[model samples]
Target: MNNNTQTRTYAYVAAVLYAAIIGLSFLFVKMTVSVAHPIDVLAHRFALSLLVVSIPVIFGWIKIKLTLRDLWRIIPLGLLSPVLFFAFQAFGLVSSNSSEAGIIQAMAPVFTLVLASIFLKERTSIMQKLFLLLSVAGVVFIFLMKGSGMSAGNFKGIALLLLSTVCFAGYGVLARPLAQKYKPMELTWVTLMVGFVVFNAASLIRHVSNGTMMDYVKPLGDASYLGALAYLAILSTMFSTLLASYALTHLEASKMSVFSNLSTLISIAGGAWILHEPVHGYHFIGALLIIAGVLGTNMSGRKRGLVIPDKA
Candidate 1:
């Protein structure tokens, strides 16, 4: 294969790994959140991710090529994700249940699609829209199958969750040009650093004000929490995002965002396998939709032919 083809293949692989890592991360999030506050969990997760990213830089292994100007450019991208995305999500989940959150979060791909088009001038083919819609539909179907629909009383949480999705979509769209300009590791480092400082500061401020600084360190005493942190910080926060940066460098933001829904499918299967959660036939059907959607979206038949609405 040519260099372009080879790199695209790697990007595809990286996207899949990103999806798997994030898919499994929900389990760890469940584990840690049960034992600790969400902000504290996020703080520790990024602290560790930042530490891991720092080690390579400290040892002169990974040279950071970022300038002050680049930092200024990318700071918002970092905040858009680990900062705003997680913050909004952490708070959004307070009143909203998982089912409600899942349904709303499914809008992320659509948000990314629109934002990429408007800001980045990224265009999609008719086939891409169909598959992207299919993938999103898969997620909504699963959440709706869980029995609770969007509650009017959860409007606050729902709005916050929608903002979180926008932040996440913003990250995806904003990273495209930046990814073309910078290496993935450089972007990843800045992202981790931003998340570390922002989340830790928020967590610490909350704990200190409550005279509960001790609560922050208490969760680490559990070995299970430690394990959860390892997976979350090292793999999910640092590596998966690195993979995302690399993928976004090679693939269009619209195509790359579609892969995020694969995590939903993986989450369901992982829950069944590890958490012993029951899976119904709908789960299988939804998984099929997600898998087929991802495949169809990425296989590259996207041409600017006659346009069709996503639903017909």
Candidate 2:
């Protein structure tokens, strides 16, 4: 295959894999946070991810090329994503249901589209804009349906999740330019390292201040908690980020972001099957709109052809 075809193939594959990883991540987040504080979980997840990713680079199996200037440019990308994105998500999940978190995350593409248009100068047709609204309407529909459940705590969680979506969307737009200059592994490694240092330091300070230094390690004992943490650290954080960085190198950020909508369906199903979360009719309806919006927003317009008159 040609280089363009190969890159597009990789982009599509990465998009699918990233979607699946993130879809199932909500379950693990919910599981881990039940026993550990969100900040503690973030610290452990990034620390483990940094360790796993460092092995290859440390052994000379992987070489990452970066100058001080490059580091300065990419640092903001890391801060936007793994640091701010996951921080918001970890805390949001603490107060919100996994299903709600998943649904809210579907809005990331809309944010990405707008950001890409503004920063990357990507064009969006009127239909694409409408479809983006459709996707958002789906989320609003769910919130309204759950009007009775809109406690102040739930509202806070929802707001945090939306903030996380914006951070992640910003990451998508920002990573595209850097992707042109860096290898996926290089970007992923730097971002993971940044998250590791920031989250661990923050957690350490919190633990020391509260005299919960020992409590920070308490969740490590439970096999279930450990398993969940392993998934979040290895698969959800590291692998998914690697996939997303690679995909962004090959695909437009707006198009790549649409793939995130697939996670909503997966999260809803996973929540129902694994967490035994209740599913209402509105969930299905909202999911349908989300799916349609994803499809419509990503669809390419067809060219019109002039037809010659047939001989009589």
Candidate 3:
């Protein structure tokens, strides 16, 4: 295959994998936070992720050449994602249900599209914009049909989650240019390292102040907790971020953001099969809309003969 074709293939695969990882991540996050504080869980997740990614670099299996200027530029990108994005999300979930959070997250594509158009000069067709809205509407439809009651207290959570979406959308837009300059592994490693330092420091201060420094090790005793943490650290954080970074290298930020909607369908199916959550009529309807929107948004690429170069 030609270089552009190969790049597109990789981008599609990365998008799919990133969506799947994120879809199932909710389960692991629930299991983790049940036993540990959210910040502590996030600290451990990134700390371990840093070690996992570092092995290859330490052993010279993956070589990365980056200058001080490059590192400075990349730091803000990391701050946008694993730091600010996750902090908002973690705190947001404290007050909001998964359904509500998922609905708000569906708006990320819109934020991403606007940011891309302004910063990257990327443009989308009217049809693509409609399909993006359709995908978000599908999520809202499912939650509304489920009759999930909301309280005034949830407004705080909703606002925080929306902020998280904006952060992630910004990350997507910012990462695109950097992707052209850095390897995916290099970018992922740096982001994970930044998260590791920030979260661990925050977690340390919280524990020490609360006199829970010794209690911090208590969660490590549970095998189930360890298993959940492992998944979050490996598949959800490291692997998914790597895939997203790689995909952003080949896909427009708007396109990559839409793929996040697929996670709603995956989450629905996963809940039914794994969590034994009941499947409802609204679930099927919402899934169909999400699938249709995803296809409609992506179909434009084929008609327009969209191709990304292998190199900047």
Candidate 4:
């Protein structure tokens, strides 16, 4: 196949995988949160990723080529994308149920579109813009209309979830220029290692201030906790991060962001089946709108047939 055909195939496959990751991530987070504090769990995730990425770096498959400037980029990215985002998300999850959180988190694509428009100056078709509006409206409708039992506490969690979206939206746009220059593996390894360092420091500060240093240390004794940590660290963080970075090399951010809506569907299914959680009509409606919006953006792009400079 020609490069164009090959690239297009990879992009579609990447989109599928992106959706799968987002869907599974909620379950993974839920499991991890059961045993470890969110910060502690995220610390392990990045630490394990740091270890896994070392294999490629040591074997010369990828190299660590960090300059002072590169560290500057990685630091903000680590803070915005992983540290702050996860902290808020984990804390919010402790208060709110997964179903509500999932719907709120699904707003990421809309957030990405708006942020990209401002920071990346990426243009979108009129159809795409309308789709974005519809998706946001759908989320609000879900929150407002869904489930008579929804509480004020759930709304608070949704608020935190929206904050997480903003953090990731900023991360996605800023990451494009960095991802283009650096090999995906290299970028993943470096940024994650930076995250590990930063989060561990923050965790330590929390430990000291809270007089709960032993709480972080105590989880090591429980085999299940350790196992959950290993799964989250290795599978969710290390494996998924590498796969996403690889896919991004072959896909557009807008397309990839749209594909991310799959997470909500996956989370909804997981919630209903695995957690035995209830799903309301509004959740389904909101999810449909979100997915429709995402599809609309991609279809709009193809219809316009305008070439966007590669900012994957």
TM-scores of the candidates in the order shown: 0.90, 0.92, 0.94, 0.87
Order of quality (TM-score): 3, 2, 1, 4
RMSD of every candidate to native, in Å, equals 4.5, 6.0, 1.9, 2.7
Candidate 4 residue runs with Cα over 4 Å from true position = 59-61, 134-141, 148-152, 209-211, 280-286, 303-305
Cα TM-score of candidate 4: 0.87
> Candidate 3, residues 213-277: lDDT per residue as tens digits?
97677888999989989998999999999999999988888899998888877766776676566
Error of 2 at 310 (Å): 42
Which candidate should be chosen as best, given TM-score against the real structure?
A: 3
Write out the backbone clash pairs for model 4: none
| Model 4 lDDT, full chain set | 0.71
Each model's lDDT comes to 0.81, 0.85, 0.84, 0.71
- Could you give candidate 4's per-residue lDDT for residues 132-199 as a string of tens digits? 66766676677677553647876676677778877766767767666667667666776677778987
Model 3 global lDDT (CA atoms, 0 to 1): 0.84
User: Residue-wise lDDT of candidate 1 within 246-300, one digit each (tens)?
Assistant: 9888888888888878777776677678767667888778778877888887775
The better candidate by TM-score, 2 or 3, is: 3
Poorest stretch of ten by lDDT in candidate 1:
303-312
Q: What is the lDDT of residue 68 in candidate 4?
A: 82
lDDT per residue for candidate 2 within 127-216, as digits (tens), equals: 777887787788678767866477899889989999999998999999987886788898999899899999999999999999889988
Give me the candidate number with maximum lDDT.
Answer: 2
C-alpha root-mean-square deviation, candidate 2: 6.0
